[model samples]
Target: MDSLLSVCDIKEDVSYIIDLAIKIKAGEIEDMPLEGKTLAMIFQKSSTRTRVSFDVGMYQLGGRAIFLSSNDLQMGRGEPISDTAKVLSRFVDGIMIRAIEHEDVVELAKYSNVPVISGLTNLEHPCQALADMLTIKEHFGSFKGKKICFVGDGNNVCNSLLLIAPLLGMDMSVACPEGYEPDENILKISKNFAKDNNTEITISSDINIALDNVDIVYTDVWVSMGDEAEKAKRLKDLKPYQVNKELMDIANDDAIFMHCLPAVRGQEVSADVIDGPQSVIYDEAENRLHAQKAILYHYLK
Candidate 1:
Protein backbone atom coordinates (compact mmCIF):
# COMPACT_ATOMS: atom_id res chain seq x y z
CA MET A 1 0.00 0.00 0.00
CA ASP A 2 2.99 2.32 -0.34
CA SER A 3 1.67 3.67 -3.66
CA LEU A 4 -1.43 3.11 -5.73
CA LEU A 5 -0.23 2.52 -9.30
CA SER A 6 -3.04 0.23 -10.39
CA VAL A 7 -5.96 -1.75 -9.01
CA CYS A 8 -3.93 -4.93 -9.49
CA ASP A 9 -1.44 -3.48 -7.04
CA ILE A 10 -3.94 -3.94 -4.22
CA LYS A 11 -3.42 -7.26 -2.47
CA GLU A 12 -6.04 -9.24 -0.52
CA ASP A 13 -5.36 -7.22 2.61
CA VAL A 14 -6.88 -4.24 0.78
CA SER A 15 -10.32 -5.35 1.98
CA TYR A 16 -9.40 -4.09 5.44
CA ILE A 17 -8.55 -0.71 3.89
CA ILE A 18 -12.02 -0.50 2.34
CA ASP A 19 -13.48 -1.40 5.74
CA LEU A 20 -11.59 1.57 7.18
CA ALA A 21 -13.25 3.79 4.57
CA ILE A 22 -16.67 2.49 5.58
CA LYS A 23 -15.88 3.23 9.21
CA ILE A 24 -14.55 6.69 8.41
CA LYS A 25 -17.64 7.52 6.36
CA ALA A 26 -19.88 6.41 9.26
CA GLY A 27 -17.92 8.67 11.67
CA GLU A 28 -16.96 5.64 13.75
CA ILE A 29 -13.30 6.72 13.49
CA GLU A 30 -12.41 10.03 15.11
CA ASP A 31 -8.69 10.78 14.99
CA MET A 32 -7.06 11.24 11.62
CA PRO A 33 -3.95 9.11 11.03
CA LEU A 34 -2.60 11.63 8.53
CA GLU A 35 -2.81 14.57 10.90
CA GLY A 36 -0.30 17.33 10.09
CA LYS A 37 0.82 15.49 6.96
CA THR A 38 1.05 17.18 3.57
CA LEU A 39 0.22 15.85 0.10
CA ALA A 40 1.82 17.38 -2.99
CA MET A 41 -0.66 17.24 -5.84
CA ILE A 42 0.74 17.62 -9.37
CA PHE A 43 -1.62 18.19 -12.23
CA GLN A 44 -0.75 18.35 -15.95
CA LYS A 45 -4.37 18.66 -16.95
CA SER A 46 -7.39 20.53 -15.57
CA SER A 47 -9.86 18.75 -13.27
CA THR A 48 -12.98 19.22 -11.13
CA ARG A 49 -13.60 16.29 -8.78
CA THR A 50 -10.01 15.06 -8.59
CA ARG A 51 -8.78 18.49 -7.55
CA VAL A 52 -11.44 19.49 -5.06
CA SER A 53 -11.96 16.08 -3.51
CA PHE A 54 -8.31 15.40 -2.72
CA ASP A 55 -7.84 18.88 -1.27
CA VAL A 56 -10.94 18.70 0.88
CA GLY A 57 -10.46 15.05 1.84
CA MET A 58 -6.94 15.77 3.07
CA TYR A 59 -8.06 18.75 5.12
CA GLN A 60 -10.86 16.75 6.74
CA LEU A 61 -8.21 14.24 7.84
CA GLY A 62 -6.21 17.06 9.49
CA GLY A 63 -3.65 17.09 6.64
CA ARG A 64 -2.72 19.71 4.06
CA ALA A 65 -2.95 19.34 0.29
CA ILE A 66 -0.96 21.62 -2.01
CA PHE A 67 -2.08 21.93 -5.59
CA LEU A 68 0.64 22.43 -8.20
CA SER A 69 -0.23 23.00 -11.79
CA SER A 70 2.30 22.28 -14.56
CA ASN A 71 2.68 26.04 -14.90
CA ASP A 72 3.27 26.51 -11.18
CA LEU A 73 6.27 24.18 -11.03
CA GLN A 74 9.69 24.13 -12.69
CA MET A 75 8.62 20.99 -14.52
CA GLY A 76 6.37 23.27 -16.57
CA ARG A 77 9.56 24.76 -17.96
CA GLY A 78 10.94 21.45 -19.27
CA GLU A 79 12.44 19.94 -16.12
CA PRO A 80 12.85 16.16 -16.13
CA ILE A 81 10.16 14.22 -14.27
CA SER A 82 12.81 12.30 -12.36
CA ASP A 83 14.36 15.53 -11.08
CA THR A 84 10.96 16.90 -10.14
CA ALA A 85 10.00 13.70 -8.35
CA LYS A 86 13.24 13.68 -6.39
CA VAL A 87 12.82 17.30 -5.35
CA LEU A 88 9.16 17.03 -4.38
CA SER A 89 9.64 13.77 -2.44
CA ARG A 90 11.79 15.58 0.07
CA PHE A 91 9.05 18.08 0.85
CA VAL A 92 5.83 16.08 0.88
CA ASP A 93 4.60 12.93 2.55
CA GLY A 94 2.79 11.81 -0.63
CA ILE A 95 2.39 12.82 -4.28
CA MET A 96 -0.84 12.59 -6.27
CA ILE A 97 -0.34 13.02 -10.03
CA ARG A 98 -2.82 13.56 -12.86
CA ALA A 99 -1.16 13.54 -16.23
CA ILE A 100 -1.68 12.40 -19.82
CA GLU A 101 1.51 10.34 -20.00
CA HIS A 102 1.43 7.36 -17.64
CA GLU A 103 5.22 7.13 -17.74
CA ASP A 104 5.59 10.41 -15.88
CA VAL A 105 3.69 9.06 -12.91
CA VAL A 106 5.83 5.93 -12.99
CA GLU A 107 8.94 8.07 -12.95
CA LEU A 108 7.52 9.96 -10.01
CA ALA A 109 7.04 6.74 -8.10
CA LYS A 110 10.47 5.47 -9.05
CA TYR A 111 12.29 8.43 -7.56
CA SER A 112 10.06 9.54 -4.72
CA ASN A 113 10.52 8.13 -1.24
CA VAL A 114 6.85 8.60 -0.35
CA PRO A 115 3.71 7.23 -1.90
CA VAL A 116 2.71 8.27 -5.44
CA ILE A 117 -0.94 8.05 -6.40
CA SER A 118 -2.23 8.03 -9.92
CA GLY A 119 -5.04 10.54 -9.98
CA LEU A 120 -5.54 9.96 -13.73
CA THR A 121 -3.63 9.09 -16.89
CA ASN A 122 -4.40 8.35 -20.51
CA LEU A 123 -3.96 4.61 -19.91
CA GLU A 124 -5.88 4.29 -16.59
CA HIS A 125 -7.99 6.01 -13.97
CA PRO A 126 -7.63 3.76 -10.93
CA CYS A 127 -8.96 6.17 -8.32
CA GLN A 128 -12.08 6.88 -10.37
CA ALA A 129 -12.72 3.15 -10.72
CA LEU A 130 -12.23 2.74 -6.97
CA ALA A 131 -14.83 5.42 -6.24
CA ASP A 132 -17.11 3.87 -8.79
CA MET A 133 -16.89 0.47 -7.05
CA LEU A 134 -17.62 2.19 -3.75
CA THR A 135 -20.73 3.78 -5.23
CA ILE A 136 -21.85 0.44 -6.65
CA LYS A 137 -21.37 -1.25 -3.27
CA GLU A 138 -23.45 1.48 -1.59
CA HIS A 139 -26.30 1.01 -4.05
CA PHE A 140 -26.30 -2.78 -4.30
CA GLY A 141 -24.83 -3.68 -0.88
CA SER A 142 -22.55 -6.16 -2.64
CA PHE A 143 -20.42 -6.40 -5.76
CA LYS A 144 -20.39 -10.19 -5.81
CA GLY A 145 -22.17 -11.59 -8.86
CA LYS A 146 -23.55 -8.18 -9.90
CA LYS A 147 -23.45 -7.49 -13.62
CA ILE A 148 -21.94 -4.13 -14.64
CA CYS A 149 -21.84 -3.14 -18.30
CA PHE A 150 -19.91 -0.23 -19.75
CA VAL A 151 -20.82 1.23 -23.13
CA GLY A 152 -18.90 3.56 -25.44
CA ASP A 153 -15.17 3.84 -26.13
CA GLY A 154 -13.12 1.44 -24.01
CA ASN A 155 -10.90 4.20 -22.81
CA ASN A 156 -8.91 4.62 -19.60
CA VAL A 157 -11.96 4.44 -17.33
CA CYS A 158 -13.12 1.25 -18.99
CA ASN A 159 -9.62 -0.14 -18.88
CA SER A 160 -9.40 0.28 -15.11
CA LEU A 161 -12.94 -0.98 -14.57
CA LEU A 162 -12.13 -4.01 -16.65
CA LEU A 163 -9.16 -4.62 -14.38
CA ILE A 164 -10.76 -4.25 -10.94
CA ALA A 165 -14.42 -5.27 -11.26
CA PRO A 166 -13.74 -8.98 -11.57
CA LEU A 167 -11.27 -8.91 -8.71
CA LEU A 168 -14.20 -8.02 -6.45
CA GLY A 169 -16.26 -10.90 -7.87
CA MET A 170 -18.44 -8.74 -10.13
CA ASP A 171 -19.32 -9.64 -13.69
CA MET A 172 -18.13 -6.91 -16.13
CA SER A 173 -18.87 -6.33 -19.77
CA VAL A 174 -17.85 -3.61 -22.20
CA ALA A 175 -19.64 -2.58 -25.40
CA CYS A 176 -17.56 -0.56 -27.77
CA PRO A 177 -17.20 0.04 -31.48
CA GLU A 178 -14.94 -2.30 -33.40
CA GLY A 179 -11.23 -1.87 -32.62
CA TYR A 180 -11.98 0.41 -29.63
CA GLU A 181 -11.71 -2.30 -26.99
CA PRO A 182 -9.87 -1.84 -23.71
CA ASP A 183 -6.10 -2.19 -23.37
CA GLU A 184 -4.95 -5.68 -24.24
CA ASN A 185 -2.65 -6.03 -21.25
CA ILE A 186 -5.29 -4.91 -18.81
CA LEU A 187 -7.90 -7.18 -20.36
CA LYS A 188 -5.49 -10.13 -20.34
CA ILE A 189 -4.60 -9.54 -16.70
CA SER A 190 -8.27 -9.12 -15.80
CA LYS A 191 -9.09 -12.37 -17.52
CA ASN A 192 -6.53 -14.15 -15.37
CA PHE A 193 -7.92 -12.52 -12.24
CA ALA A 194 -11.45 -13.51 -13.28
CA LYS A 195 -10.34 -17.08 -13.81
CA ASP A 196 -8.89 -17.19 -10.33
CA ASN A 197 -11.94 -15.50 -8.78
CA ASN A 198 -14.53 -17.54 -10.68
CA THR A 199 -15.96 -14.33 -12.18
CA GLU A 200 -16.92 -13.50 -15.75
CA ILE A 201 -15.64 -10.62 -17.89
CA THR A 202 -16.66 -10.12 -21.48
CA ILE A 203 -16.48 -7.55 -24.28
CA SER A 204 -18.56 -6.99 -27.40
CA SER A 205 -19.59 -4.39 -29.94
CA ASP A 206 -23.31 -5.17 -29.62
CA ILE A 207 -24.87 -2.76 -27.16
CA ASN A 208 -28.04 -4.76 -26.60
CA ILE A 209 -26.23 -7.93 -25.63
CA ALA A 210 -23.99 -5.87 -23.37
CA LEU A 211 -26.91 -4.31 -21.56
CA ASP A 212 -29.01 -7.44 -21.15
CA ASN A 213 -29.61 -8.18 -17.45
CA VAL A 214 -26.89 -5.81 -16.36
CA ASP A 215 -27.30 -4.37 -12.86
CA ILE A 216 -25.39 -1.21 -13.81
CA VAL A 217 -25.26 0.48 -17.20
CA TYR A 218 -22.23 2.74 -17.40
CA THR A 219 -20.82 5.08 -20.06
CA ASP A 220 -18.34 7.84 -20.72
CA VAL A 221 -17.86 10.49 -23.38
CA TRP A 222 -17.45 9.09 -26.88
CA VAL A 223 -14.53 11.41 -27.35
CA SER A 224 -12.30 11.97 -24.35
CA MET A 225 -9.90 14.80 -23.40
CA GLY A 226 -7.45 13.96 -26.20
CA ASP A 227 -9.85 12.84 -28.91
CA GLU A 228 -11.26 16.04 -30.26
CA ALA A 229 -10.43 15.11 -33.86
CA GLU A 230 -12.69 12.05 -33.70
CA LYS A 231 -15.62 13.84 -32.11
CA ALA A 232 -17.81 13.94 -35.22
CA LYS A 233 -17.32 10.31 -36.24
CA ARG A 234 -17.58 9.22 -32.63
CA LEU A 235 -20.86 11.07 -32.25
CA LYS A 236 -22.16 9.22 -35.28
CA ASP A 237 -20.75 5.79 -34.36
CA LEU A 238 -21.87 6.01 -30.73
CA LYS A 239 -25.39 7.26 -31.45
CA PRO A 240 -26.67 3.69 -31.41
CA TYR A 241 -25.13 2.97 -28.01
CA GLN A 242 -26.55 5.95 -26.12
CA VAL A 243 -28.03 5.04 -22.74
CA ASN A 244 -31.51 6.30 -23.54
CA LYS A 245 -34.77 4.92 -22.24
CA GLU A 246 -34.82 2.30 -24.95
CA LEU A 247 -31.36 0.97 -24.15
CA MET A 248 -31.98 1.14 -20.41
CA ASP A 249 -35.18 -0.84 -20.92
CA ILE A 250 -33.08 -3.82 -21.96
CA ALA A 251 -31.27 -3.86 -18.62
CA ASN A 252 -32.57 -5.13 -15.31
CA ASP A 253 -35.65 -3.25 -14.14
CA ASP A 254 -33.74 -1.83 -11.21
CA ALA A 255 -30.57 -1.21 -13.14
CA ILE A 256 -28.87 2.08 -12.29
CA PHE A 257 -27.13 4.36 -14.84
CA MET A 258 -23.63 5.59 -14.10
CA HIS A 259 -21.34 8.07 -15.82
CA CYS A 260 -18.05 9.45 -14.62
CA LEU A 261 -19.11 12.96 -15.33
CA PRO A 262 -18.14 15.97 -17.30
CA ALA A 263 -20.58 14.12 -19.62
CA VAL A 264 -21.44 15.52 -23.02
CA ARG A 265 -25.22 15.85 -23.25
CA GLY A 266 -25.73 14.25 -26.65
CA GLN A 267 -22.41 12.48 -27.06
CA GLU A 268 -21.62 9.56 -24.78
CA VAL A 269 -25.00 9.69 -22.99
CA SER A 270 -28.30 11.46 -23.52
CA ALA A 271 -29.43 14.34 -21.33
CA ASP A 272 -32.58 12.51 -20.25
CA VAL A 273 -30.72 9.43 -19.08
CA ILE A 274 -28.17 11.35 -17.02
CA ASP A 275 -30.93 13.39 -15.41
CA GLY A 276 -33.23 10.40 -15.07
CA PRO A 277 -34.20 8.77 -11.79
CA GLN A 278 -31.85 5.86 -12.42
CA SER A 279 -28.84 8.10 -12.91
CA VAL A 280 -26.36 8.21 -10.04
CA ILE A 281 -23.65 10.30 -11.72
CA TYR A 282 -23.73 12.85 -8.96
CA ASP A 283 -23.49 10.23 -6.25
CA GLU A 284 -20.59 8.64 -8.12
CA ALA A 285 -18.91 12.01 -8.33
CA GLU A 286 -19.43 12.78 -4.64
CA ASN A 287 -18.05 9.42 -3.56
CA ARG A 288 -14.74 10.46 -5.09
CA LEU A 289 -14.12 12.29 -1.83
CA HIS A 290 -15.09 9.46 0.49
CA ALA A 291 -13.36 6.69 -1.45
CA GLN A 292 -10.16 8.66 -1.87
CA LYS A 293 -10.17 9.57 1.81
CA ALA A 294 -10.20 5.85 2.38
CA ILE A 295 -7.25 5.35 0.04
CA LEU A 296 -5.22 8.10 1.70
CA TYR A 297 -5.92 6.70 5.13
CA HIS A 298 -4.90 3.23 4.04
CA TYR A 299 -1.52 4.25 2.63
CA LEU A 300 -0.72 6.87 5.28
CA LYS A 301 -1.53 4.52 8.13
Candidate 2:
Protein backbone atom coordinates (compact mmCIF):
# COMPACT_ATOMS: atom_id res chain seq x y z
CA MET A 1 0.00 0.00 0.00
CA ASP A 2 1.16 3.58 -0.72
CA SER A 3 -0.15 4.99 2.54
CA LEU A 4 -2.35 3.85 5.43
CA LEU A 5 -4.68 6.85 5.58
CA SER A 6 -7.65 4.57 6.19
CA VAL A 7 -8.24 0.93 7.02
CA CYS A 8 -9.84 0.41 3.62
CA ASP A 9 -6.48 1.44 2.14
CA ILE A 10 -5.25 -2.05 2.99
CA LYS A 11 -8.29 -3.68 1.34
CA GLU A 12 -7.65 -7.47 1.46
CA ASP A 13 -4.24 -7.11 3.12
CA VAL A 14 -5.73 -6.42 6.54
CA SER A 15 -4.97 -9.96 7.65
CA TYR A 16 -1.40 -9.67 6.52
CA ILE A 17 -0.59 -6.83 8.92
CA ILE A 18 -2.64 -8.30 11.78
CA ASP A 19 -1.15 -11.78 11.55
CA LEU A 20 2.28 -10.30 11.13
CA ALA A 21 1.72 -8.37 14.35
CA ILE A 22 0.70 -11.55 16.19
CA LYS A 23 3.80 -13.34 15.00
CA ILE A 24 6.04 -10.39 15.77
CA LYS A 25 4.59 -10.12 19.23
CA ALA A 26 5.12 -13.83 19.79
CA GLY A 27 8.80 -13.42 18.77
CA GLU A 28 8.22 -15.75 15.86
CA ILE A 29 9.66 -13.22 13.46
CA GLU A 30 13.34 -12.69 14.10
CA ASP A 31 14.36 -10.37 11.34
CA MET A 32 14.68 -6.67 12.06
CA PRO A 33 12.91 -5.71 8.86
CA LEU A 34 13.19 -1.99 9.44
CA GLU A 35 16.85 -1.89 10.39
CA GLY A 36 18.75 1.11 9.05
CA LYS A 37 15.57 2.98 8.23
CA THR A 38 14.08 6.07 9.87
CA LEU A 39 10.52 7.21 10.44
CA ALA A 40 9.45 10.83 10.91
CA MET A 41 6.58 11.13 13.35
CA ILE A 42 4.86 14.52 13.34
CA PHE A 43 2.37 15.44 16.01
CA GLN A 44 -0.17 18.18 15.58
CA LYS A 45 -2.16 16.59 18.38
CA SER A 46 -1.18 15.27 21.78
CA SER A 47 -0.94 11.49 22.18
CA THR A 48 0.04 8.69 24.54
CA ARG A 49 -0.47 5.34 22.84
CA THR A 50 0.13 6.65 19.34
CA ARG A 51 3.37 8.32 20.36
CA VAL A 52 5.08 5.73 22.53
CA SER A 53 4.03 2.77 20.40
CA PHE A 54 5.45 4.09 17.16
CA ASP A 55 8.62 5.45 18.78
CA VAL A 56 9.42 2.23 20.64
CA GLY A 57 8.32 0.13 17.70
CA MET A 58 10.96 1.73 15.52
CA TYR A 59 13.65 1.07 18.11
CA GLN A 60 12.64 -2.58 18.51
CA LEU A 61 12.84 -3.00 14.75
CA GLY A 62 16.37 -1.57 14.74
CA GLY A 63 15.28 1.67 13.08
CA ARG A 64 15.09 5.20 14.42
CA ALA A 65 12.12 7.48 14.99
CA ILE A 66 12.29 11.25 15.19
CA PHE A 67 9.57 12.95 17.17
CA LEU A 68 8.63 16.37 15.80
CA SER A 69 6.04 18.26 17.78
CA SER A 70 4.09 20.70 15.61
CA ASN A 71 5.57 23.61 17.55
CA ASP A 72 9.08 22.57 16.58
CA LEU A 73 8.61 22.68 12.81
CA GLN A 74 8.42 25.54 10.31
CA MET A 75 5.13 24.01 9.22
CA GLY A 76 3.85 25.11 12.60
CA ARG A 77 4.88 28.65 11.62
CA GLY A 78 2.62 28.61 8.54
CA GLU A 79 4.96 26.92 6.06
CA PRO A 80 3.01 25.04 3.39
CA ILE A 81 2.66 21.32 4.09
CA SER A 82 3.77 20.55 0.55
CA ASP A 83 7.16 22.07 1.28
CA THR A 84 7.34 20.29 4.62
CA ALA A 85 6.42 16.93 3.11
CA LYS A 86 8.99 17.27 0.35
CA VAL A 87 11.70 18.19 2.81
CA LEU A 88 10.82 15.41 5.26
CA SER A 89 10.47 12.79 2.56
CA ARG A 90 14.13 13.30 1.70
CA PHE A 91 15.15 12.88 5.35
CA VAL A 92 13.00 9.95 6.53
CA ASP A 93 12.09 6.55 5.17
CA GLY A 94 8.42 7.08 6.08
CA ILE A 95 6.15 9.61 7.78
CA MET A 96 3.61 9.00 10.54
CA ILE A 97 1.49 11.98 11.50
CA ARG A 98 -1.05 12.33 14.26
CA ALA A 99 -2.89 15.28 12.77
CA ILE A 100 -5.80 17.42 13.85
CA GLU A 101 -7.03 17.58 10.28
CA HIS A 102 -7.25 14.57 7.96
CA GLU A 103 -6.73 16.80 4.93
CA ASP A 104 -3.27 17.77 6.16
CA VAL A 105 -2.10 14.18 6.13
CA VAL A 106 -3.62 13.68 2.71
CA GLU A 107 -1.87 16.74 1.38
CA LEU A 108 1.42 15.57 2.85
CA ALA A 109 1.00 12.11 1.33
CA LYS A 110 0.08 13.67 -1.99
CA TYR A 111 3.41 15.48 -2.09
CA SER A 112 5.78 13.03 -0.38
CA ASN A 113 7.62 10.29 -2.23
CA VAL A 114 7.79 8.16 0.94
CA PRO A 115 4.76 6.53 2.49
CA VAL A 116 2.66 8.40 5.05
CA ILE A 117 0.89 6.51 7.83
CA SER A 118 -1.64 8.35 9.91
CA GLY A 119 -1.12 7.90 13.63
CA LEU A 120 -4.49 9.48 14.27
CA THR A 121 -6.72 11.96 12.47
CA ASN A 122 -10.20 13.42 12.84
CA LEU A 123 -11.42 11.12 10.08
CA GLU A 124 -9.84 7.77 11.12
CA HIS A 125 -7.38 5.91 13.31
CA PRO A 126 -6.31 3.09 11.05
CA CYS A 127 -3.36 2.03 13.25
CA GLN A 128 -5.61 1.65 16.28
CA ALA A 129 -8.05 -0.42 14.27
CA LEU A 130 -5.20 -2.73 13.23
CA ALA A 131 -4.16 -3.26 16.84
CA ASP A 132 -7.80 -3.76 17.79
CA MET A 133 -8.11 -6.55 15.24
CA LEU A 134 -4.94 -8.12 16.60
CA THR A 135 -6.36 -8.10 20.11
CA ILE A 136 -9.66 -9.59 18.94
CA LYS A 137 -7.93 -12.34 16.99
CA GLU A 138 -5.63 -13.11 19.92
CA HIS A 139 -8.53 -13.42 22.34
CA PHE A 140 -10.90 -15.33 20.05
CA GLY A 141 -8.42 -17.10 17.74
CA SER A 142 -10.56 -16.19 14.76
CA PHE A 143 -12.71 -13.47 13.30
CA LYS A 144 -15.23 -15.85 11.75
CA GLY A 145 -18.78 -15.25 12.96
CA LYS A 146 -17.70 -12.65 15.51
CA LYS A 147 -19.91 -9.68 16.26
CA ILE A 148 -18.27 -6.48 17.52
CA CYS A 149 -20.34 -3.57 18.70
CA PHE A 150 -19.12 -0.05 19.46
CA VAL A 151 -21.04 2.15 21.89
CA GLY A 152 -21.04 5.95 22.39
CA ASP A 153 -20.11 8.64 19.88
CA GLY A 154 -19.30 7.14 16.50
CA ASN A 155 -16.06 9.03 16.27
CA ASN A 156 -12.79 8.26 14.48
CA VAL A 157 -12.15 4.99 16.31
CA CYS A 158 -15.68 3.82 15.59
CA ASN A 159 -15.32 4.93 11.97
CA SER A 160 -12.11 2.92 11.48
CA LEU A 161 -13.63 -0.09 13.22
CA LEU A 162 -16.66 0.07 10.93
CA LEU A 163 -14.41 -0.04 7.88
CA ILE A 164 -12.44 -3.01 9.20
CA ALA A 165 -14.83 -5.35 11.07
CA PRO A 166 -16.75 -6.36 7.95
CA LEU A 167 -13.60 -6.84 5.90
CA LEU A 168 -12.29 -9.28 8.51
CA GLY A 169 -15.48 -11.38 8.48
CA MET A 170 -16.92 -9.87 11.62
CA ASP A 171 -20.26 -8.15 11.90
CA MET A 172 -20.16 -4.56 13.28
CA SER A 173 -22.75 -2.50 15.10
CA VAL A 174 -22.72 1.02 16.47
CA ALA A 175 -24.93 2.31 19.29
CA CYS A 176 -25.04 6.06 19.53
CA PRO A 177 -27.42 8.98 20.04
CA GLU A 178 -28.79 10.67 16.95
CA GLY A 179 -26.67 13.36 15.23
CA TYR A 180 -23.58 11.59 16.59
CA GLU A 181 -23.30 8.96 13.88
CA PRO A 182 -20.14 7.84 12.08
CA ASP A 183 -19.15 9.86 9.05
CA GLU A 184 -21.81 9.43 6.36
CA ASN A 185 -19.32 8.79 3.56
CA ILE A 186 -17.37 6.29 5.70
CA LEU A 187 -20.60 4.54 6.67
CA LYS A 188 -21.59 4.22 3.02
CA ILE A 189 -18.19 2.83 2.07
CA SER A 190 -18.20 0.38 4.97
CA LYS A 191 -21.65 -0.80 3.95
CA ASN A 192 -20.44 -1.47 0.44
CA PHE A 193 -17.47 -3.46 1.77
CA ALA A 194 -19.82 -5.38 4.04
CA LYS A 195 -22.05 -6.24 1.11
CA ASP A 196 -19.13 -7.65 -0.84
CA ASN A 197 -17.72 -9.48 2.19
CA ASN A 198 -21.08 -10.99 3.16
CA THR A 199 -20.89 -9.46 6.62
CA GLU A 200 -23.23 -7.00 8.34
CA ILE A 201 -23.11 -3.42 9.61
CA THR A 202 -25.78 -2.03 11.90
CA ILE A 203 -26.23 1.42 13.42
CA SER A 204 -28.76 1.89 16.18
CA SER A 205 -29.77 4.41 18.76
CA ASP A 206 -30.86 1.61 21.10
CA ILE A 207 -27.78 0.29 22.94
CA ASN A 208 -29.48 -2.98 23.87
CA ILE A 209 -30.31 -3.91 20.31
CA ALA A 210 -26.80 -3.10 19.12
CA LEU A 211 -25.03 -4.82 22.00
CA ASP A 212 -27.24 -7.91 22.13
CA ASN A 213 -25.27 -11.08 21.37
CA VAL A 214 -22.19 -9.15 20.34
CA ASP A 215 -18.73 -10.61 20.99
CA ILE A 216 -17.14 -7.30 21.94
CA VAL A 217 -18.55 -4.25 23.74
CA TYR A 218 -16.31 -1.36 22.77
CA THR A 219 -16.44 2.32 23.65
CA ASP A 220 -14.46 5.56 23.48
CA VAL A 221 -14.74 8.99 25.03
CA TRP A 222 -17.91 10.85 24.12
CA VAL A 223 -15.87 14.02 23.72
CA SER A 224 -12.74 13.55 21.62
CA MET A 225 -9.69 15.80 21.44
CA GLY A 226 -11.22 18.59 19.30
CA ASP A 227 -14.67 18.22 20.87
CA GLU A 228 -13.77 19.73 24.24
CA ALA A 229 -15.52 22.96 23.29
CA GLU A 230 -18.80 21.06 23.36
CA LYS A 231 -17.93 19.07 26.45
CA ALA A 232 -20.89 19.89 28.70
CA LYS A 233 -23.49 19.29 26.01
CA ARG A 234 -21.78 16.09 24.85
CA LEU A 235 -21.53 14.77 28.40
CA LYS A 236 -25.28 15.28 28.90
CA ASP A 237 -26.26 13.79 25.56
CA LEU A 238 -23.95 10.78 25.81
CA LYS A 239 -24.58 9.98 29.48
CA PRO A 240 -27.12 7.33 28.55
CA TYR A 241 -24.68 5.58 26.23
CA GLN A 242 -21.88 4.97 28.75
CA VAL A 243 -20.54 1.40 28.76
CA ASN A 244 -21.30 0.53 32.33
CA LYS A 245 -21.75 -2.97 33.73
CA GLU A 246 -25.44 -2.76 32.91
CA LEU A 247 -24.77 -1.84 29.30
CA MET A 248 -22.03 -4.44 28.88
CA ASP A 249 -24.31 -7.11 30.29
CA ILE A 250 -26.41 -6.75 27.16
CA ALA A 251 -23.65 -8.40 25.14
CA ASN A 252 -22.78 -12.09 25.08
CA ASP A 253 -21.47 -13.63 28.30
CA ASP A 254 -18.07 -14.04 26.64
CA ALA A 255 -17.98 -10.52 25.29
CA ILE A 256 -14.83 -8.49 25.82
CA PHE A 257 -14.68 -4.81 26.77
CA MET A 258 -12.32 -2.36 25.00
CA HIS A 259 -11.43 1.29 24.94
CA CYS A 260 -8.80 3.33 23.16
CA LEU A 261 -6.64 4.52 26.02
CA PRO A 262 -6.53 7.73 28.09
CA ALA A 263 -10.15 6.92 28.80
CA VAL A 264 -12.23 8.82 31.29
CA ARG A 265 -13.41 6.05 33.62
CA GLY A 266 -16.84 7.40 34.51
CA GLN A 267 -17.64 8.83 31.11
CA GLU A 268 -17.05 6.34 28.32
CA VAL A 269 -16.83 3.27 30.59
CA SER A 270 -17.43 2.45 34.23
CA ALA A 271 -14.57 1.37 36.47
CA ASP A 272 -15.96 -2.12 36.93
CA VAL A 273 -16.43 -2.95 33.25
CA ILE A 274 -13.15 -1.43 32.02
CA ASP A 275 -11.16 -3.09 34.80
CA GLY A 276 -13.19 -6.30 34.73
CA PRO A 277 -11.90 -9.79 33.88
CA GLN A 278 -13.06 -9.59 30.28
CA SER A 279 -11.41 -6.25 29.57
CA VAL A 280 -8.58 -6.66 27.06
CA ILE A 281 -7.70 -3.00 26.81
CA TYR A 282 -4.13 -3.31 28.06
CA ASP A 283 -3.46 -6.11 25.60
CA GLU A 284 -5.14 -4.00 22.95
CA ALA A 285 -2.92 -1.08 23.80
CA GLU A 286 0.31 -3.10 23.71
CA ASN A 287 -0.61 -4.50 20.34
CA ARG A 288 -0.29 -0.99 19.02
CA LEU A 289 3.47 -1.46 19.05
CA HIS A 290 3.43 -4.72 17.14
CA ALA A 291 0.73 -3.62 14.73
CA GLN A 292 2.52 -0.35 14.14
CA LYS A 293 5.73 -2.28 13.61
CA ALA A 294 3.94 -4.28 10.94
CA ILE A 295 2.82 -1.05 9.34
CA LEU A 296 6.28 0.49 9.45
CA TYR A 297 7.70 -2.63 7.89
CA HIS A 298 5.02 -2.69 5.23
CA TYR A 299 5.58 0.88 4.08
CA LEU A 300 9.24 1.41 4.89
CA LYS A 301 10.87 -2.00 4.49
Best by lDDT: 2
Can you write out model 1's per-residue Cα lDDT over 132-208, one digit (the tens) per residue? Answer: 88889889998876999999889899988988788788889998888789999989998998898899889999887
lDDT tens digits, residue span 22-126, model 2: 888889877777889999999999999999999999999989999999898999999999999999988989999999999999999999989999999999999
Worst 10 residues of 1 by lDDT: 11-20
**Candidate 1 structure lDDT:** 0.87
Estimate the TM-score for candidate 1. Answer: 0.97
The global Cα lDDT (0 to 1) of model 2 is 0.92
